[model samples]
Target chain A: MDKMNGAQLTIKLLERFGVDIIAGIPGGSNLPLYDALSHSTTIRHVLARHEQGAGFIAQGMARSSGRPAVCFATSGPGATNVMTALADAKLDSIPIICITGQVPQSLIGTDAFQEIDTYGMSIPITKHNFLVRSARELLEVIPAAFRIAGEGRPGPVLIDIPKDVQLEMIEFADWPAMPQRECVKHYRKQDILQAAAMINAAERPILYLGGGIRHGNAHDAAIRLAEKNNLPTTMTLLGLGSMPTNHPLALGMLGMHAARYTNLILEECDLLLVAGARFDDRATGKIAEFCPGAKVIHIDIDPGEINKLRTAHLQLVGDAGSVLAELLPQVESKNRQDWLNRMAFLKKENPFIMPGADDPCMPYGLIRQIAALADHETLIATDVGKHQMWVAQAYPFCRPRQLLTSGGLGTMGFGLPAAIGASLAHPQKTVVCFSGDGSILMNIQELATAVEQRANVKIFVLDNTSLGLVRQQQNLFFGKQYFASEYQHHVDFVTIARGFGMQAFALGASDDPVATLTKAMQTQGPCLVHVPIGRNEEVYPMVPPGAANKEMIGGENHASA
Target chain B: MQALKESYPCPPSDASGQKVLELTVNNHPGVMSHICGLFSRRAFNMEGILCMPIGDGKLSRIWIQIAGNSHLDQIVKQLEKLEDVRSAVLHPAEHEVFAKLEEYFQGS
Candidate 1:
């Protein structure tokens, strides 16, 4: 501990923040963190095959654990490779602390080898990025990175430490906290009042929640407000766990891949209250055409999000929980019979669709049954794939932050690490991660990180033996040519799971997969459930990237667009 | 009256499309929304813009593409006077591939 380098000091601080494992790739720049990591018994670094995988694993861990997870890589290419995952963290509002080593402070502006403007490159995707110009600055920057990453409206924060600074001897001073400038703009009383009155008066009020609900820790207040107002609700993909899925008012999801009823009701509604959810291009089909008849009320902790999109008639910029708490008192309870009746009618028509197969193994059935059997407070982290979509459509999540998935960046390998983080954050709660075989392969090495860190995570691999999402796209858009999407040689995922000293279960283990999942959900430690699904499993109701919501493909009928 | 006389001729409708946005970004907020907002609402071809830091903090200088000389001139003047604005200048995009995306939007 005495006279440690900047990397060593920073790693020790991270240990204090409960980081037992770090996913990273070492290079000339981050060689110090890797070097310091060898001498320290508290931190273990897991080397990823790719920087993107490393970044995603960290994102996964942060999302599941509800704590800022750490990742590292060298300058330039390594940093560039991780940009997609970092961007995913930014959009989904995950607390990921990404550290990359720069060439050197003196050589920063120069066209030195492997040097790029990483801080600037990451600015668009990070909650805050710091260029540690001085070695001493790490003391302040490291802790601030954690705070900014985990605080209100959580998102990834990047810290770019120069190689020289990492090696340089630095004196330690107590870390400083970021000064809170009295936000020149807070939600005005009139704005809050106007929003409440509108909500109370509206006949068809629908609450479209987003990841910010969980990020801001506004779950309790949101639940109360929703319940008190008897408001029907729908969430964006990132907003899945904002409220219980089985809650009478829950519309599951409300965008491209959303439930049919949710889409129908949202389109017909007269009043929409957007809480902590931005009308992203992904969520809002076409901006001009989205919710045309509705009056939107935007409430957010960050003012920048207000009126930045699908324009709101009443904008309330303040703490989501605080504003809701104040506005709840001003609200009057009312019912929208026509809206409720239409949602009921549409819900019956848009019931959860399941994959049809002759094989006994069913991923959708298993996820739904497992969700019902699992504890109500359990956390379910998911990777990007077709099975991930099945779980999203099937899983009955009851609590905020219970259903975790990467929305904005849609990183494939996010499940396992995120589940680790969630388990670490809430040890008492059961943590289940649903991943695709292709997705798991992206960062499967993190199983060792989970085992070493004593982070108990249950990983459910929907092994359709293919790049499910891509194959679905190929099937739909690319004329079903079926190029390279298939995983021709199935690597023994069970063996890989056992190699990490995890309890591995196969769907074919017994006559029933639901039993295996139920047992795994009941047990502790990182478990892997290799779910045997069909190779051609396609995610239904998909909004083909830039296509409008009404132009949904698949799910309703398999005849292809 | 003198300024009006000096200004370039423009349709009243085209004038509404020429506007400036002075934003105080959260050190973390992405500018994609701001960019999209301008493009979607203006629905017109844009000229050029500049962005730089005005302060030691997260406050960034984001200058966007404007169309029509007289309209562009008025926007620059008005935007510079916005409270959060440290300084403003009209930066016309000169020889950039993105200039096409601007051209497609600028029917006005």
Candidate 2:
């Protein structure tokens, strides 16, 4: 038996789990772990300027590779900084393991310097968290964290390693087997048959897709179900890439800001075949009135989500891929031409178009041009606000997991770090981040991380000089009395990028925006393009608060300023 | 923290307001934290919690005393969905687990 410190054993377990990269920043409490990391040749550490950036970077890798990713931080401020990302990952169900160094066990409750109850503070944010009291506990705790993080309905898990525990030496001889997770599917055979019967009988069936399809790796099953039955498909914000946007049967996203026709179709559908979706308030405006006359056939792996909100007529609790594949054999193929014709007519009668049609300097025109330049393999991420909505509305995503953005938490500054993670996960692929000026600054410190890793990520900052979403809401709902939303500073983002040792370009409102953006995307390693737009540009086709989805204010005929 | 307890929906005038939630879960390092975390995140307070390993070292049973509310049922369902949790059952407030434990502590 060989004597090894707890820190050394932790790294060995990570290696055993096939983790090659970790994003983190070191502090006083975590010096032992960093010391161990320095000795290891297998794990490459990317030093993030901030802990939150490291967390989101881990999220990006997990979302892209469909595997649990790792991040590290120290105690107190380090742990607090990573809180938002933990909450974000928990809500979005991305599998990530976060390790933070804690004070010695004896000093845990004495309020030692740089010590906060990392375990207690993390309870509300993490799916599970640990504070290792003994060196030997690492053997079980490390494996348990990984199991909880990567199992069904995956989420973020935390392990707070005390400084003394990391330094303690123990004679280690054997490694334990991984925890056993139950793979027993929970849906009854009769439920799938009943759902198929409902699908067969309904004349107008809309398949409501969600992020679970991507998590469950059920994209093929979802597309086959839609095409086999000639059913139209609609998506939640995180469900964008579940069905190819350009497919003939695909209706764009359905939500508060969804296209008018998609909402109209949802309101009229006789059966809503919901797959892997939790009926979020944003997706279902005024839940009482949403899909007023539809029988829902809900399929999800988490039994808790089956009837958490809206009760389903038939609930099938299993992996979306398995359930959909099983149900496919029971379903009989049929075409409803009258329903297809109605969809085509609605699209023709009321087309969903961006506000700016001709000028590339405008936000919509610039986003359209960028989407056109990228291929289906391109991975895109967005920060919160109007830019996120614009990209969600207009971008054409052709594959599952290609679009990674914060849907449940809607955290700002998620785009850049996430894009960096995606780029690092697949170096051969292109990753683009569409960000607002307000959001890019939230985690702007991560530009240094992207430069260090040489990640192939292109960041476009839409400088509206204000929090566009908040400004728009204030204008419509609060008599245009906007305060604190507007930025009074003259901060130059391109200068900041150049300062971080990255290639950068700043385009004026009239400068060839498309050409500059295209050049930046092709230039290589990491680059940024700044495009300024008017403050008044707002997202349209918005269903006001307390309004039904069909009562939209904008479409092709009307563009609200 | 006490304010969290006040928010629980009181039982109908005829029944006791407290209920016991029993959970069977894999005996692991951080399983307790996950259950407690769920309650903390929702701001749903539990009056008391008891945990003990079962026959073999592989599994454990947890009993939580909580005020009854509309949200309690949903909480039980979610607790059962955790990877470590095997089953979650609700018992009346008069269930013997807590009452027996109280007698043991008092006698000791």
Candidate 3:
């Protein structure tokens, strides 16, 4: 009379949560979930080579889907392997539900070979976590896991399903659809009006956009307000593509590595329009000195963010889409022609310098070519270090959540698994993971998982033969000692990907890489593109940590070391 | 009378000067998100936020500082009525301490 079994209950829950694809690696304790998954027609399982890769794929999927993605592994070692990605997801605020099969409840903490405290290990990184102690609680827990993972500014959640419990039969019940989501509230209105007045009356009003606009689908509304109110716009790295990059009003990514003109304009602006973007340390260096002369118009959906560390004059608390829809018409047009003209002058005055201009295939040039071939909705995930920053700068994104990189965490080996998640989330969309050689080696075994899953996640390796970021730092700060920075061994990521059943390619060109990337994009199944980038090249416009944004250095090509 | 009044003019001031905002919410799992998400979702500028634990671990108290309020009536109040939010109050401090901090930052 029970609903099939524990595995069936989990499968049913997965269907309910709209999980179409899962990236996982099965083992001793997790066998039952896999057994159930195999029989289930709705949810597809993609086996990863390693647990960490599986975690990243789930992360990628969750970021793109705006829903929790799933990854599975057996207890102990498998669960431990997933820790790095879980922490990475926590920092990026991606919603992924990690389901690991645990040893029988009785075997827990008995020093069993595969027995480990999976729940305790995940508690810190997960927004919420659970340990399914009984088969009877299966239905509630499955839905509960999703509820926690998907709602209220989504983040990762973990569910440790014991092997014995997973195999046991249990009754099923339909839980109510009321998502136990947290209420959304923020600053009072009388004060919000007070803030907006300063902005409307200012001579130079500039809008600094962040990821929230895309998450809220408030892009059009933002543009309407910007155009109507004569407000120029700048985007955060995550906010890239929220507004079109080519728009005359778009100021591009602004911060340490931002265009000199963007930072200059932001510095001189009289009124700063900040929306849906956190004043992360990277974005606003020397916080006190940031926007020194500007009056900030703060609008956000979360109250806690309004004044955690940054000051704003006015505040709004509502979904970006809903609030912008309401307030767009209320904006009064101001003729800030002088401001626009000055910004234009700045843009013309400071052009980015490129490294290896004459060389056929420079790293920056290669990334630009890759971008050109990339679809409007093609999802790009990058590993940590200089390659990640390069992708952030070179990729022209037009969609929200389209680019999923380890921003807050900056974890290496994050790209491939996240690519798996992104690809699984959107089977029709192209998903590319941009990783450095060193980062790829960290979880390269997952290439087998990609082969098994057939998630069509492509990878691009920027092989520079060293820990590029570390080497750069060591060169700049440590007088080029190169301690723990240089790696003598080079990885043949292309061959490795091919051996793991993926298609592979290599490129060496100075101009755009559109043609090669277009070919790669056309391929099916897992693929890897290996590009040998120069080691000395650095991501320029550094703020040197604890410095003001105005203290940025270098153009694209200035010698890093 | 129309309940929605056209509040003319966008209020302007540098809100980054930091202040305290108190929020009361039902004890719930997503309360933190509701508080944090609002800032990210609406493009609000936030600084020095502390969600110090409060009352029976059921109610949450929040302190936030911000500058702009374009959608205060339209958004903030509605959020308060959501399942989690019980009340939200923006406390304006015109005290000498706040004044002194401002003067210190201004290098006066």
Highest-TM-score candidate: 2
Off by over 4 Å in 3: A1-4, A172-183, A187-192, A356-360, A509-518, A556-561, B1-108
Give the per-residue lDDT of model 3 (tens digit) for A1-561: 446677777877788767888888899998888888888788878778888888888888778877778989889999999888888776666778888999988888788879988876675577667788787777667776677665544567788988888888755555435246554444455554565567678887789888777666778888888888778899887788777776788888888778777887888888887878878888888889888898777677655466655777666765677666656656677767888889888777776555654342677776777777677878888888888887777667776777887776777888877787787778888888888988888878877777776867778888888999889878767788888777777767777777887888877642445566777878888888888887888888677677888887777333321
Q: List per-prediction Cα lDDT, in the order shown.
A: 0.72, 0.86, 0.73
Clashes of each: 13, 0, 66
Q: What is the number of residue pairs that collide in model 1?
A: 13
Least well predicted 10-residue stretch by lDDT in candidate 1 chain A: A176-185
- True-structure RMSD, every candidate: 7.6, 4.6, 8.9
Alpha-carbon DockQ of candidate 2: 0.27
lDDT of 1: 0.72
Best by lDDT: 2
Ranking by DockQ: 2, 1, 3
- State which docking tier applies to candidate 2: acceptable
Name the TM-score of chain A in model 2.
Answer: 0.97
**Where does candidate 2 stray beyond 4 Å?**
A178-181, A509-511, A556-561, B1-18, B24-37, B43-62, B65-69, B82-86, B92-108
Angstrom error of the Cα, residue A8, model 3: value is: 2.4
Q: For residues A1-561, write the lDDT of model 2, one tens digit per residue.
A: 868999988888898888999999999888899999998888989898899999999999999999899999999999999989999999898999999999988888898999998887887777777888888999999988888887777889999999999999999788867776545366678888899999999988899999889988998998998888999999999899898889999998998789888998899899999988999988998888999999999988776787777889998877788899998888888888999999988877777876775566788787888888888789998999999998999888888889989999999999999999998888998999999999999999999999989999999899999999999989888899998899999689989999999999887843566778778879889999888889988898898887878778766555332
